[model samples]
Target: MVQLSNNSALIFDGLALESYVSGKRSFMRTPSVSLLLPSPEGTRRAFLIMRNVTAINPLCLPAKAWQQNVAAAVRPAQLPGVQSHSGCHNQTGTCVDDSNAPVWQRCWKQVCQNIDVACSGARLNSAGNPAPTYYDINLLDVALFCPVVLDQACLDSLGPLGCTLLYESGAGPGMLPAAPLAVALGDATGSQGGGHGSATPLVVGVIVGGVVLLVVAVGVVVLLVRRRRPQAQTAKTGGAPFHEGLDSLGTRSTTSAAGTVGLSMLPTESTARAFPTMGSAGSGATGSGHAAPSTWPLPDANKRAHSQGSDTTVITNQTPIGDCEFDVKIEMPPQDGVAGACVGGSAQPDVQLTGIVLGRGAFGRVYQGIYNGQAVAVKLLTELTVDSADQACEAMMQELEVLGRCNHPNVVKVLAASSLDAARPALVLELMETSLDKVLYAKPGHLLSLQLVLHIALETAKGLAYLHPTVLHRDLKPANVLLRDPGSDKPVVKLSDFGLSRIRHSVLKTMHPEAGTPAYMAPECFDLTAGGLTHRTDCYSFGVLLWEMLAGAQPWYGMTAVQIAYEVTLLSRRLPLRPKNTPGGQVLERWPHRLSALLSGCFERDPQRRPAAADIVKALALAQQDLDNLSRRATPTRTAVE
Candidate 1:
């Protein structure tokens, strides 16, 4: 694992090895990383090199490699603008095409052509300019090459002379040194100049070179005699000596932390198989530890285990459903109050998750996921759920069944869904930033304004109105309602969580195995003896929802489920019509009394007396108009000069 200064890293997990002197192929590809390096002087200053004993695999590394610190430099082969020709210095007067190119060209072109070789960088300097990032797939131990996976495709591109690179011989074979005066000699001789006309200049250079060499030799002898000490021995790492950070040598580190990547590399002659989302299967042959990416947010019960590097919510103590046994079919929703006939409809496919949990609920947990390049929220069953794993699957499937048939603005749109996981079925939905409950309780005493409250109420009612004819949202509450742009004045409301919702085909809908939050459950829900729940059951919940929005608190705050059930069912009581003892509570009082009166109707103990979703929408609309008209008259407008 070589971590680039700019967070770009080149990692090798698993591969076989070959010796450097006889190495022909390179397994590691430079384009796999994105690196940006500063070029203050500009013009191709440095490029990357991956010289290693083995294919960057931890399993292949010996114990000594990890024992002590070894420093290796990621130095470039050529000097700045030296213009050195190819290494193929043919004694026979035969010309080859690639023989005339620069020193690093073979390593550069050999890197995959499909990949964009030039880096579109992100790291910048004081002037806000990005550094130049270059890659040369020449990461072979110059002195000790390793056997790689690729047979011949990854071989060095340059011909026979290409085997010897600049790192071994400074100016490349048959080329003049890049030193100060030596550079002028090469330039005068020219790339193809073989005429005797350059004899006089060559003769003058030899005399000057001899004199300069004598003076430098004498100076070195005096310094060595005075010091009388031997040169310090480095750890003698495989590559050049290097350090950390963005310096003259660049960000590439030669040696890094060791880890294994299981390539399923077989001793038999065969190619390895890997996917985009490959799990880390290190070679246990070396006892190297590894872990899978923990993108999934686990439940509260599993939080402690997760903190200690354990896996996220895994289904246990439950039966798993393999091939989904449930059959799915849906009807096209009614348009213009005319219901469409039943038709063959298919359920959505299962989605892959990154294991990141976003939110959790009674029955299901939500995880952040991506589908077809779009971010989505995938709902899966929690470790500890509403009832059993079976019920959780039932609820997820039920929600999918309902959402598949409906397409309304206020309703949450389902992108994909599948209950094949059985114990942990998935429901992928369009990602919403926040939920109404999250925003409402973001801070204590953070009350919603009259306009904002009505906006939510109106949208929620419209969604209910759309669903009432065919289905009923049995569990309606703040958490179930999603908000798109919560920061804006008019945030869009999307009614979600249809697990408790059921198709209203029967006049008396019997909610068997009765399950719902007792605080929001209608009074009729408590008594199974009374006529089973109706569309108006949602009306009771809507009434509580309004009170919650107005007061910025729970309807029966600090009360247990049993206490709430006793108070609502046995006592037949509803929340106060006005938001009492709350900040911005007076905003509701200032509004027209019609909204309050509508709330009273929604809370009617008798299901028949409660307003239907359609009627509630009409009443909220009227109340909105009255409030707006009152605002116009109350405002003191600029008087015209008479």
Candidate 2:
């Protein structure tokens, strides 16, 4: 230690500041000396030792020796019920260090307040569990330091004799340094949240910044999307200009003209701006007049003129724009006596084929097709006994009722239907190629990756979630599932074929004659005595479907339909698989344990035990997140490969 001749001291080594410094900071060395604060009783005083003195000239002292010297110099305070000690000893009473207690308590309270603020601010604990924040060391640093400073300031404000200016001062209000300036300083500088009124500006700034970014991104995207949309429409049109005169004539045309028929004509610019293609009708013209002469190489001038001449006769008979009464031409099938039907021949064009048969049963055959040139699958009801046909028609009507009300990506879409011929009713649907059965069994060598399986489960649950608890898919099976090429980062798996679906308004009354795939049939189906067509039946079917996805095949097999039903009913045989691998073991051996447990829950023997599809979706999504975390580090197991 160096003592200047001027009675000043210098210390640099191992010095823990007992109080906040008052002025511009400077280091000095001091001979181990005890400092005192006068007590309430003038004769008594609080004493503490300063240690490990180092002079400005680089003098040093062993920390322990310095501590000993400081201890020797300190005098115990003579306060009632208080025991004071030198430098480092544990001391008790008002005379000892309660200096930091209030500060720490205040800091702790703020920590809890901050947590509450975060919870409320982020909207966590809402309808669903909040997505977790990524662990951030930077935020932690801020959290840790903010309180430490507050605690120091809290101590300083409560106690006197410390340098208040250096201790309490901050760059801004409410950001006062509670602790040492060194501890308080960080790379970050900003007010976190202000008073209620002040908070608005910061929030506004953040929102404005976000909105600015969003607007910029949206603008760029709109520009690109605008450019691309027109290009796409033009390309799809085969470079035809349907809107050339649309702006001036206030007429509109669309690519749909190519869908139902070939070339459709429009009146010129003074009359109608855009042309209608084949079969579609417009307000000004009758749709049925001369069909385009050829499918390919759309009509040349001579051919068009010839067709126009023929159309003039038909147009003359049709109503003009202003006429209250007009004979509008309507497209109708050419008049012919109904073709004689062979016993097994398709009744009219109710059923069409694409050679890709998805499923066939006693009820009907479902084949993928190109309806109106857009891909669709057509289901033709097979001839059945009068009673079975009636039952099947009833089922189809119920399905149509349910599907019509539902508009979700995961649920199958019902398009056009032909009920005109009760003998051969048909339904047209958007085509989806991959069926759960095809995914499970058709491709023998492929393994059901954990990711794809979870996705299917999630999507199925989503579909079920859309339906009220009263409605149920009585016939949930692999065959009922259809996959679409969603053209996305994570393309979706869609559920299709609502044919055995039922919507019961309530427990009061529901259709009977229990039916569904045998292997997927829930045990409740066997309980004909009790009505089993509730949502629980769907749950049971879901369980079986989950089992199939996990197992990569149907749960039960090798029996006639009757025998399978008997076994399912009498044996109470659940899917014969577990999460582990053995001969005929659980589905994918590599699936996550949590996912396996979730799948088991779906297939539970008791209907009441099963989680709702919404909960299931939540669980699967969580599992998917876990899988995604693992996926980011490596190629995801759930790539939607063709």
Best by lDDT: 1
Each candidate structure's TM-score, on Cα atoms with residue i matched to residue i, is 0.44, 0.42
- List runs of model 1 lying over 4 Å from the truth: 1-355, 382-387, 419-423, 511-514, 584-591, 640-642
Give the CA lDDT, 0 to 100, for residue 585 in model 1: 57
Q: Tens digit of lDDT per residue, candidate 1, span 1-642?
A: 111221122322212222111111111211122212222232221233333222211011111221110111122333112212122111234322221122222111111111111211122234522222332223333221111111121112221112122212222222111111101112111221100110111111001111223353344334323321111122221112211223233322222122111101112222221111111122221112332121222123212221110111111101111212132222233458775332223444334455567797766568787666677787766564455767676666667656655556788877655434443456668898898999889998888777788888998998887776346688898989999899887888899988876543223224341467777888868764332456788898898888788778777888997788788767877777665665545554533578778889988876667898878889988877887887888887778322
**Best prediction by TM-score:** 1
lDDT of each: 0.45, 0.39
The residue-by-residue lDDT of candidate 2 on 555-591, one tens digit each, is: 6656776777677667766665463432224434445
